[model samples]
Each structure stands twice: as C-alpha cells, then as structure tokens.
Target: MNQLNKILVLNAGSSTLKYKLFNATNANKTLALAPMISGMVEIGEVSKVTHKSHGENPKKMELPDANLNDHRSALSLVIDLLCDPGFGGLASKSEINAIGHRVVHGAERFKNATLITKDLMAALEASIPLAPLHNPANILGIEVATELLGDACPQVAVFDTAYHSTMPASAYLYGLPYHLYKDHGVRRYGFHGTSHSFVAKKAAKHLGKPLEECNFITCHLGNGASITAIKNGKSIDTSMGLTPLEGLVMGTRSGDIDPAIPTFLNKQTGMSYAEIDSMLNKKSGLLGLSGDADIRNLQDRFRAGDKHADLTLEVFAHRVRKYIGAYLIQLSPRLDGIIFTGGIGENSWILRNKILKDLEHVGIVVDKSKNEVDLTSQIMSVESSKSQVPLLVVQTDEEKSIAEQTFQVVQG
Candidate 1:
C-alpha cells in the first residue's frame, strides 16, 4: 500500500482559490491527519494570499500588483508560498505525495473519487456546460497543479456530484420529457456530495451507530448551499438539481422558482434568456429579496427592526423548514436526525432555533439553552428532551474527506 506523506486539496472558484495541505499517513487504506498548512488566494482585481501552517500564525500577504490573471499564476504563487523556508508547508514541491481537486460537476460519468489522467481531463471537458461556473476553474486548478508538481505526485478528483449517484430515477428526474434526460443528461445531479457524505458519516459516528444503519438529512447552509436526504448512508435525494441552482435559497441563487418564470420575464420585458439566467443565478435569492445575502448581516438588521431583513430571514428559514418536513416524510419511521453544517447552519443558533420552531409535532426539538451554547464538533448534539429526533451540528471537513479519498485512489 502507498503511504501518504502529504496531500494538498484545492477548491478553485472563478476568481478565488483555496487550498489545504494535510500532513497525513495512510495504513491499511485508512488516513489520518497531523498538523498541516492551509491558505486562500483572491484572483480578481485585487489579489491577496493568506497562508497558515500548523502552530504558526496565519500570514496575509498583499501581492505587489499581483498577476493573478489566471489559475496558473495563483498556483505558482501557492507553490512559492509552500516552499518559503520561513513558514512554508514544504521544503520542496516534490514532497507532495498527492493532490486532490474539488470538481463541482462530474455528471453521470464520474460516480466516485477518480485519479486524474489525460483521458479524465477530456471527459471533464465535456462536463463544462453542466457546471459552467465551477468545473472550468476546477480543471484549471488540476492542470496548474499537475504542471507544477509533475506526474510523480498523483492527482485525484473528488467530485461534488459523486455521492448523489445513488439517487433513484424517481428522485433525480424532472417532469420534463424523457428525451431531455436520455439525450441531454438533464437530470438532478446534486452538488456538495462531499460535504453531505462526510457529515453523514460523522453524524453516524456521533450517534454511535454503523453508517449503513443510520439515516439523516444533512443541511449544508453556506453561501452556496444544499440539503441531502441520506437513507442508510446513501443519498436517496438532495435539494440541488441538474445545477446548484435548484435547491434551497442561497446567498444569490434563487431556488425552486416557477418553471415558466424565465419565459414570462422574457415575454413581459423582452429580456434575453441569458439575461434572465444571470438574474436568477446571480441577482436573486436573499440578495435580490433584501439587497443583502450574508445571514450575519441580515440577522443583525433583522434584530434592529429592519423589515426587509426580517422577511428575508423568515423566507430563508421557511424554505429550510419546508425541506426538512418533506425529507422527514420521505425517510418516515427510519429518520434518525437532522444535521446542520456549513456557515449559517453551524454558527447561527438563532436560525437553527427558528427552523426548529413548531417542529416538535414531528419529534424534532432543540434545547434552547443548549442551542445557544458553544458546541464544537466533538459536542455536536443539540437535541431537546421533548424531541425524539436529534438535532446535530457537525463541522464539516470536506478537505479532509478529499484527502482521504485521494489517498485511496493513490493507494490503489
């Protein structure tokens, strides 16, 4: 078996890049981490890099008119940072045993973590239209890392859609004609599979049950969000559809709108399809509703009697509650717990309280005092005595999951 020395996981966005380097050792196909290095790079108009190694203070460096015009430049800078003798993660780029990439859309072709290759890259290129906003950047990150680290360090892809591959046709299919799905592959391929899968296993561990016996509804409520319905460790259904835009209301994407709205807008206002698409994906959601999308900012304003913020919070919580109710019915008597992860889910107790309100009839309750307290990953339970179903807040570590998956592929 190939023992992992160091693994670097990269999540590349349109104009931003984030990476985490793990100090890991693999034995018998299991991987565990030690102290590691992590960082992020902003690649837009103004570029910056934040690098942090274990036991060292995070250092934020402003690149001098940084030429972060592309993923290559950003990755080159990252390699340089990792090699800096002062506080870098490695003395040489060659020390990295493997690199794992977070590819947003794998479609139906890639159902699990895959080792990157020339043929794999060609297949990923065909998946671009499915995730126009994300997969290109993901591929670019992989390409740059491959060029920088060379073929000696194996590269793997941990796809966001892989875990949802188990969803049945009834769950993933849309009402559209069968040909659309058969010919175009236009079906619900959910995003955030990595986070959902990782947290589901974590929740299973926390509940002291084998993952194959646990059922859960995991809420990943970050800027880009999705909720997954897991039955016995497999994703039976998820919120997001063919794209990440189909699920719950997020920071910007408008989720679950009427199907006719796009044509309606085009006919009513003579707007192009592209314009309407951009509006729904970029200008809608909490931002479109109240002009602010960050839950923190909206919550603060909501507390201060801002009616718009109040409505936004109510709408957001309502959507989440709606899904939880549906998933509860879907999972039925076997429903184990409702998991909360991601930014808003983990940090905003007020939102959790709001979501859990009036859910007691369904055996889902939250201890008010317990919910208000500081709960780390080790102490994830927030279940109320009146509740039969547990309310867990698991701090998801997708980077770690990626590294472990990558290790497995490299080991094989």
Candidate 2:
C-alpha cells in the first residue's frame, strides 16, 4: 500500500485565508476528494477562524475572537489548531509533508507549479504589478507558512494564471502599442486557471477521452466569473485579461466596460481614478444593476417581478452566452463539451437556462429537468439527447488540484 502524505493548500485573499489539508498517496500523488481538515481565517481588527475536521468522528469549531491581526498571525493560530487535541490533533507540525499556495498571478514568468524558493519569491514580487490586489496576500501567506512551518516542510506555489499561460499572442495581447506589452508587460493574463483546468480534465474524463484530445469551453461562474476556450488541453483564449476585470459581468465588477470609461467618468463626474476603480471593482455588476450582489437575492427579486433584478440576470446571462457563442466558433469542428462550474454555474439552474436558451441552433441544448437537479454531490450532464455537444456541470476542486500539483513537485 502507498503511504499517505499530508498536503496543506492555502488560498489567501485580501481579507480571508482559506485552507484545506488533504491526505494524498505518496506513490502516485492521487489526492483524496474530501479534505481531512478544511477551514478559513477571516483577518481584521478582530479575526475569526472556522475549522472542520473529517473522519469517523467529525468535528467543527469557530474562534470568533481569534487574536490575529494579519495573515501571519492567522496562520500561527492555524498551527495551534492543527496540533490541538480537540482540533486537527496531529502528532506535530512535522506531520505536514507539503504546503501549496494559490498564487493568483504568475504573469509570464512562472507557467507551472514551482517549488517555493528565494529566487521564485523575488520573481513573484516583480509580478505584483500584474496582480496588485491579490499577489501580495498570496505572498504574505507563503512567507508566513515558511516562517511558521520552517524549512522542513516543502512548499509549492500553484499559479492561477499558469494554466492560461498557453494562450497565444493574438489571444493575450492587447491592441495597444507593441512597446507597452514588450516593455511593461501589458497583456491579458487570465485568472481562475486552476478551476478551469480542473474542470476541463474532469470534462475530458467524462467524455472518455484524453485531455490533450478534447476541446472544450469552460465557464467558471461565481462572484468572479470567466470563460475559457480550451483546445487540445491547452488554454487558447479566456475572457479575463491582465486583471480579473476584463471578462464576464461579475458580482461586484463591471466587466468588459469601455477602456475609456474610467477617464470618461473622471471627466464627467469629477471622480478620481481611484474612486472610479473602486466603483467598478466593488460596486458594479449585479449589485450595480439590481442593488444586490448575491445571485440568490437577485433571483428572489426576479421571481418577485423586480424589473431591475430581471435586467441584472439578463445582462449576466447575455454576457456568458455571448462568450459561449464566441468560443464555439473558436473551438469549431468537434468541440467535445461545454462545462459550467463554480458557485453560480453549479447551483443557478435559472441562470444556466437563460445562458443556454436559443443556443440550440448551434447544437447546444439544456435539459431543463436535468439542469434543475441538485449537483452538490456529483457531476452531471444537463444537455438534451438531441444536442450535438455535451453540457456538463462539473464540481471544481481547485484545492485538490493544488495538493496534487504540490505533491508532484515535492516528490520530484
């Protein structure tokens, strides 16, 4: 029997640090679907830690007043929780074999999961300009993990933009001056690559084909959404560009707006660039249109006959459908599947119905009954029998993907 190695995956956001601990086979690096330990730390003036441990006897605990001001302190608290008898109760920190971090942007420098090192850390710092809002937090997490866990445990950086790094110049390059891209690295670098890559592999397996032989359009719809056109297992193009704000309409982001809108708002409303940036990134999308950011709340209002809510849903679906159509043409002549994953994509049948409606002419059809079925436990195809292509709802497991990648790097 292959020995099991403990792998910890951490996703550090601006204000939250989410983590999951998996037991993976040391031989093949196959990860267990259910994490042995999963939790998150909410960082602020008064921090909070929510923890869950799974086994024969499951356990859960919440520290509402965790004394953690930042990611470092929060991760220190996590170490304690892991060793505490009542919590994860591991023998010691040495039991953790490897750590995987979800680094949001790797730019063009790091295109694969890499072992964390001083030189790589320097490279990540240099790429910060490409992901100003996310990379710092991710770097902080890596630093803290290294500090607290020490050099005994191997650490790997799983990049979100790495999977999309396969995109050609025509897809990633902007129409701006060549020197801007050549000098300042101004170009599209898609996000949510781990999710898209995870689901695409699963979609290929579902279609009984190797990933390199399959062509797919993957839609990862959540608070932050993006679509990818996958050709022969590589990302040919994706919706998000440079930052995550260039793709589909998101929960709090005004995606795909005119490039001059910021300056226009600056000129018209006397709003500073920072203010306009804040408005677009934090106060737009469903929130901007329907006065709410949560899709469930927006759906509630829509069912209650709210016109603004109706428009919000329509705009969101329209943008997604538009991308689907574009990707269909991009991946023409034997597209194996169209996959929907992430929070909104997996749960919101109404939105899926809206996005897929009238797409039958292109051989895409959603089976209403199958679409409405609960997908919390398993992946399912919601496409009709008459459809030429399969429409799949895949449950994306990015943490597992990270763990698998991390284990591979560590083993090598």
Candidate 3:
C-alpha cells in the first residue's frame, strides 16, 4: 500500500456517464490540490461523447458513431480519452488507482460505500426495480471498469440511499398494505445521500464545529431536489421516499399526488400503467405544473403573469418551507441551523429569499445584503446573531466523497 492520492469517480445516469478524476494527497504535504478531470458521455436516442481534463472546457470526442453501440462501448471510449494526452486526458490509464461509483439505491443492505465485488454487484442488480433507471447504468460502469482494470485495482460502490438508511421507522413507513410493504420492500428510502452528506459535513466545517455535534437540515435543490434532516452527522429523515419520484417537484417528475391518481386516470384516459408511469416520471413536475420545465422559462412566465408558472413556483417553495418547518418541529430545540446546496439551492438567491423570507417568527431572518452576496463563495449567511443559528450555503462535492471511500476500500 503506497501513499494513495489519485481517485477516479464515476457518476452514471440512464443515458449519461459523468466522471471526475481527483488527486488527493496528504493535506499537509503539498499546497497544490489536484485538479479535477471530468466529462460526460451521453448515449441514448442521440449519442455524443465529451471529455474535459483538469477542469478545462470539454473536447468533443469524435468517437465512431456506429462502433459506439451500447453502454460498454461508451465506457471503453471514455477510458481511451482519459488516457489520451493530446487532450486534457490524464495522459495515462495507470493514473487511476481506484474507481468509485455513484450507486443510486442500496435499500437497507448498504449503510456506507463498499468495495465492489461479484456478490455485491448481483445484490445491486437485484435492487434494480427500486431504481430501474439509475442502478443499471452504475452497475454497467462498474463491470466495464473491472474488466479493464482487473482485481488489482479496487473499485467501490457508493450508494445514494446509504446516508438516509438511518431514518427511523416512523419516518420511512407508509400506511399502505402490510403485505405490499413487507413483500416488495416498498418503504421510504431517500435518495441524494452523497449530496446531503457532503453539504452537511461542509456545514460543520464552515461552522467550525465537530461534525458529530452538528444538527442541521440540508436542502439539495436542482432539477432533482431533496431536503435531508441531518442530526449529528447522520440522516435521520429526508423528503424523498421509496423512490426519487416521491418528494420535491423535480424538473420532469411528479413528486406526489393522490394515491388513487392512476386508477382515476386509467378510467378517464384508458392509459396503460407504463404509459402513465412515463407521464408521471418524464412529462410531469415543473413541466407539468407550468407549461415548460426550464426554471428560466418559469421565471419568464411568472414575470409575464402566467398564473400556472407563479403557482408552480409557489407550490415548489411551499413544499420546501413545509419540510424545513416540519424538520424544525420534529428535531426541536436542538436544531442548530439549515444548509443549502446543489444547483438551485446554492445558486438561486431568489429561492433562498422565498424559503427563508418571513421566517423571523421562527427565529429565521436573512440580511438581504448578505443574501445577495456572490454564491461562488461558501458559508453564505444572511442573518447574524451572537448565538445565531447559521444559515449556510455550501457547494457540495460528492465526487470527493466517492473518491475518499474508494481510497479506503482500495487501501483495505
């Protein structure tokens, strides 16, 4: 075992493979924090491969269109480009000591990142129904990497649901049929584990407090949104349920509605289950709420007095506020502060104003001047009190977490 530093982190979606290779040496040794080399290869109805080395702008990898048949080929091309020196590629395949994967769901089976093995892969594949769209791609990437790297280089699986595995039964269970709940493993296992975990840790760092002593709520808002109740470094509860489709109104997914919706719509439109699922998962959410899914579009429509757009934003903000207050009440007196991360949470000050506005009665206030500060900086706080609960805006780095876990596994 040598001084482990470089780590390759892979984040695979249904049709996109995004990656970042990080160099993490002993923090005390050198000041040159290794650069992040990243890119995404999108392979779906339309195919495109892109790569960016050392945080530079991505170069279009002109891969042979016909040869790139499936996910496997996509992975192969990615490896080649990462090794290509003409581009920002790391210039050597051997630079990656270990690979860490972003696995979407692990149910209750995994509480932390585990080294990927044949048995673990099978278990991950079995959990596919719980994450029909995400886990398969992640698993595919692991297999492809293992085939190319072999057992000599360890690979790790970091579950998105792992952080929320600490949720108490009261928060995770639903009053559905007992058999369905027991048989299908259909219970609320929240997603966005790594993002929430990263920001929560980031909050602790910014607050200059021991991570184990911090209690906070972290909202990861983006196209996919979720709020996590972090009590002393563990996820006690979260907004997302058994699936990512259950919580916040995402860019293109319906979060929640009446349980009888499918039956009612079936009778009305005679749509099949798959068709309805697609509509709810793909065609709904902000897109369904307003006329379009783009937040800018929503903003434009709202300014133009589009009722639905305004209403949609209201519903979105309302849900976030509800969760904040709910967690406040649930966690009570021990609550320290709230943290925000992810795309919308970190960048959208308007959203911060909407969620944090008028919360003075609950001892929450925002100094508009501080709120308007540049988002690129961390530790964003609006209100300051002598013993004030901190409202922090942290930019999350889940890839670093993945690499750290991968390093541990490889070292072991």
Candidate 4:
C-alpha cells in the first residue's frame, strides 16, 4: 500500500490560508465531511473559516472578533477543525502523509514540482524579492507545516510559474538588455501556470483528443487575469510578464499600461516609485475604470443602463478579444479553440459573449442560447454550430492540480 495516500494542499496568503485535503488512493478522491477550508486572520478583523465538502452541508464558523494574529495561529485553527470530531475529516494529523504548498514565484530555476530541501528553502528565500508579497507567506506555510507534521511527512512545493517555464525565449523575452535576463533573471515568467495547464488538459479530454496533439488559448479571467497560448500541450506564450501585473485588465490591477506611465507619474506628481507601483497594482484596472473591481458588479450595472459600466465592460472585452486574436495568430495552423475559466470566465456569459463577438470571420462562434444559460460550476459547451474554433469554459481547479502533482512526486 502506498503510504502517501492522503495529501494536503495549502495556499497561504499574508492574512489568509486556503487548504484542501484529498484522499489520493483512488484517483484523488475527497473526504466525505469537508474537503476544503478557507480561513482568514488579521489584527482587527473577525476570524472566519468556511468548510465545503462533498455530500455534506457546507459549514461556517465565526471565531471571536479578537485578533487571530498570524498565519501559524490561523493554520492551527484549520488543523483543529480538521481534527475535530464534529467537523474534522481525518482521525489525526498523521493520516496526512504529504503536503503540497503553492509557491507563487519560482523565478527561472524551478521548472517542475520539487521536494522541499534545505537548499531549496534557501533558494526560495533568495527569490523573495521576485515575489515579495507571496513567497514569504508561502515559505511560512511550509515552515509551519514542517513544524506541525515533523520530518516524517514530506512537503512539496508546486509553483505557479512552473508550467509556463516551457515558454520559448521569443515569447518570454522583453526588448531589454540581454544582460538583464542573463544576470538578473529579468524575463516574462507568467503566473497561473497550474490553472492554465490543468484546464488545457481538461479541454483536450472534453474534445476527445490527446492533450499533446491539441492547441488551445486559455484565459484565466479573475481578479488576477491572464491568457496563455498552448501549443501541443505546452505553454508557448502568456499574458503575465515577469510579474502578474501585465496582461489583461483585472479586478484591481492595471494590466498592459504604457511602460512610461510609471515614470510619467513619478515625474509629474512627485510620487515615489513605490507609490506608483501600488497605484498600478491596487488602484487601477476595472476598479479604476468604473469605481468597482468585481466583474459581476460591473455586469449588473451595465445591464441597468449605466454608461460608465457599459464602457468598462467594453474595454475589458476588447483587451481579451485582442489577446485572443494575437494568440490565435501565434498558434494558427493547429488552433483548437479559446477557453474561458476562472471566476469571470466561467460565470459571466455577458463578458464571454462580448469577448467572442464578431470573431466569426476567424472561425469562432458562440451559440447565443447556450451562452446565456446560467451554469453553477460545471463545464459545458457554448459554441455555435458553425464555429471552427470552439468556445470552451471550465471552472479552474488549481488545488486539485497541486494535489495530483504532489501524489505523482510522492509515488515516484
């Protein structure tokens, strides 16, 4: 029997932790009580945890409004809940044989899931400047897991930028000095690789073709949106640059702005580089365009005769359509279809419809009726009968992908 049958996947943020527990003995199955848990802890906020499991009622707990304080404290609460007789899934922490952590920036070094070693830990620390906001939290998660589970349980680091490591030099390079890329690792290392990779394989399976034989353009449209051009099962090009701030318009992120805008702001407004960076990453995008960052809110306002909302939706759709066209050209000969995933991509038919509009000349079509139907979270077809390129939508499952990858590494 495989000792690494139960796997735990953790995505730790500065103030939050999202986790999923999977029984991987028979194709990555889930526990009956609660398979996923999300917990939030901060200085002056009410700590909250939500649990969702298959074949059971979703449960939520509101902890005391006092400060839960740190990631370690928050993670302890999650472990407590998971081991609780009333809500826990496993009998003990020992049942979990392996843990998979989501590390956001792997630079150019880590191309695949890797076992966490002392040297790997040092490398992750060195790469901290590349992902200041994310890698620290990720490293903290691994440290806490190690402390709690001991050396008996193996820990794996599954990177977000790992899948896009296959991107060719032509696709990943910027028009900058060669020494920048060679010495400082300055290049377009796209984010959301796990999501893009999983959905591309899923798209191939749905089309009844081998993943290696298919081509696809996957748009992971969400708060942090990105588009990827997949050629023969590998990422050839993607929207996100060295950081996730490039690519499509996103919730609060100003994507694809003129490279000179930051300098212009600094020169004109006397804003520091840090201030301009914060504005672009936090104050721009759909939020800057229409005073709201959530797409659902923009969509609701657009339907109710809001002109500003209408324009915001148009700009968002236009950027996505533009990328779709470019990626199509990049993967022209064997172009399969365009896929929509993530929050907005999967739920917002209005956004998806606007994105695919008038692309009939390019062999892309949308079935108006099917496109408008509300889908809770299932993958369904919304392609028109005449479309040479199918429009596909899938709810991206990054945790599931991490769990499967962790199992593979452990089994090997």
Candidate-wise lDDT, in order: 0.88, 0.90, 0.80, 0.85
Candidate 1's residue-wise lDDT over 1-412, tens digit each? 3464888899999999999888887666466776577888989767877777776565544455675778888999888888888768687988888899999999999999999999999999999989998989998899888888888889999999999999999999999999999998999999999999988998898889999999899999988888999998899999999999997999999999999999999999999999999999999999999998789999899889998898888888899989988998889787888999998888989889888998777788789988986556543788888889988999988998998898888878
Query: How many clashes (backbone atoms < 3 Å, residues ≥3 apart in a chain or on different chains) does model 3 have?
Result: 1
Q: Which candidate is the best by lDDT?
A: 2
Estimated TM-score per prediction? 0.96, 0.97, 0.92, 0.95
Candidate 2: tens digits of C-alpha lDDT, residues 1-412: 1367788899999899999988776445444545788899999987888999988898999989987788888888887788888888477888888999999999888899999999999999999988899999999999989999998788999999999989999899999999999999999999999999999999888889999999999999999999999999999999999899888999999999989889888999999999998999999988888789999998898899988888889999999989988998899887899999999999999899999898778888889989987796648999999999999999999999998888778878
Give one digit per residue, the lDDT tens place, for model 3 in 208-251.
Answer: 88889988988999899999888878888998888898877888
The residue ranges of model 1 lying beyond 4 angstroms of the native Cα positions read 1-4, 27-30, 56-65
Please report, as a residue range, the 10-residue window in candidate 1 with the lowest summed lDDT: 55-64
Error of 4 at 267 (Å): 1.3
Q: Model 1 Cα displacement at 69 (Å)?
A: 1.4
Q: Tell me the tens digit of each residue's lDDT in model 4 across 1-412.
A: 2733678889988877888887665435532222444444442265665654443565666555645677777777777777777666778888888889999999999999998999999999999988888999999999988888898998899999999999999999999999999988889999999999989988898999999988999999999999999999999999999888998999989899889998898999999999998988999999999999988888889899999999999999999988988998999786887889998998899998899889888888899898997776547789999989878888788988898888777766
Measured by TM-score, the strongest candidate is 2
| Candidate 2 weakest lDDT stretch, 10 residues | 25-34
Ranking by lDDT: 2, 1, 4, 3
The alpha-carbon RMSD values of the candidates against the true structure, listed in the order shown, are: 1.6, 1.6, 2.6, 2.4
